[model samples]
Target: MERAYKYELLDKYIDQELSDKERQELDALMTEDEEFKEEVEVAVMMNASFNVEQKQRWAKLLEAEATKTSVQPSQPTKTSETDTDQKETKVRQLQPRTRWLRIAAMLLPAVFALFLYLFLANSSQTAPQMADHYLSNRHQAPTITMSQGNDLSQNWKTAIKAYQEEKYESAANLLEPLTNSTNATAEQHFYLGLTYLYKEKAEPVKAIQQFEKSQQLNPAQYSAEGNWYIALAHLKNDDWTKAKPLLEQIVANKDWKWQTAKEILEEQE
Candidate 1:
């Protein structure tokens, strides 16, 4: 029953009719449950389809009303027997046309609604594929540089090599211990976070934690990249609310990733 209730809440959410507490509950579920998130996505698409259908129906109704008004017999110019005969003939001629118009007006909305539903259903099926492609294409490993006295250890070089070779799990294992060391730098934490993002089974929330730590430790050096990765982490989880502010900040700063961030924001909108 609770599950059924949550499903019903999706409709209220799409309609923007949920109360504050209910909205919070739904948000939590979406964050924690992938299935719930997909359900919400479907609900949103269906709501868009219904909105289109309603608009089409209204347009058809208005057209039908306009046709009816236009076809109303004009006031008789003169009340004479010959004029009466001509007016009767005109009404007879219009009756069949008006009937056909009314029938078309009633049928068109149903036809449009069916088409919209099929189109939206197909789009929903393809959305996940599109998201996967975008993520895979956009998330390239960033290059790293070290100062003369601050050269990275052999382990760090090996980790970097592993990451470049697409062995993200191996890279993450090597970097994990480095992040916990007292001498760990912001760069170390940033790359560790990125490995989590690139791994076959990503851990986005974990990536966000590490990226936040990296930003805090060396805001001057890693701030822009940190913000970009954090936004990507949230995006990976389908948490647009958290990602949007970060993307907006990147765009406003005209940062290195500003163009990509702007494109993402536009797509979301």
Candidate 2:
């Protein structure tokens, strides 16, 4: 059934055995589905734990072999030629087993090292890939709400309608005037920033500036959201250093967005 196929795909993903196409599909699902994302996280953690356990098991086996090899029989101070020959024969008989053990010990460490290198490489790639997905999904226009009797202009209303309709160019053009106006509200500035992000010819740097202005105008209302978007903008621009501090702040605050921020930070590490 379809459900069984999905489970099998997930198993392949966790084992790092998925083909490129399958991996891409899974990555897309992870971005869109929170439960699926959490499942993948758990799977990765379990896989890493399993690898560690196997490494420990191999280490113990190697140690036991080493201890066995070290325990040689004591030789007599005065031994007959026949006794020496007998000892030599015994040593020859053990050499093959000892050589095989040494080979196994060397191969096991190499195998562990290879696994470690692959895990680290894969982990490093996961964060940047997730960031890309986050940015792509985040470009959708945000819902706009207004209070009754507010001073919002007709142009602002039109801009919101345009954004909702995915007419990002028109939305950006309409919001531009409000952004430049002296009496612009923090909400206007924030929406303008979102418009820039959604526009076809995206202006992420401009978006960042507008978001920053919004935060300055009304930190109490816009600070947390502003910080989150600014960090996302930096990520979209591939400026991880700039994004890191903002994500850390979100994580420290333990806000609603903290879980996602923490995941991004973990990927970066």
Tell me the whole-model lDDT of each prediction, alpha carbons only: 0.76, 0.75
- Compared with the true structure, what per-residue lDDT tens digits does model 2 show for residues 1-269? 35666567788987779999998888888889899788878888988989878876775555666556556656544388888888877877777878776666566766544434333323455433444455555444545556632666788888888978888799889989888989888988898887776667667799899999999999998899888888877876678889899999999998648987897787778
- Which pairs of residues have clashing backbones in candidate 2? none
Model 1: pairs clashing at backbone N, Cα or C within 3 Å: none
- Cα displacement (angstroms), candidate 1, residue 85, comes to 55
Q: What is the lDDT of residue 195 in candidate 2?
A: 74
Per residue, candidate 1 scores C-alpha lDDT tens digits across 1-269 of 35587886887898789999999999998999999899789878988989978976775656546457446556556689898889888877877877776666566757544434432222342322323434565345556565632566878888878978989999999999999999888888998898888888889899988998899999998899888888888878877788889899999999868987886777666
Q: Provide TM-scores for the models.
A: 0.49, 0.50
Q: What C-alpha lDDT, on a 0 to 100 scale, does residue 245 get in candidate 2?
A: 92
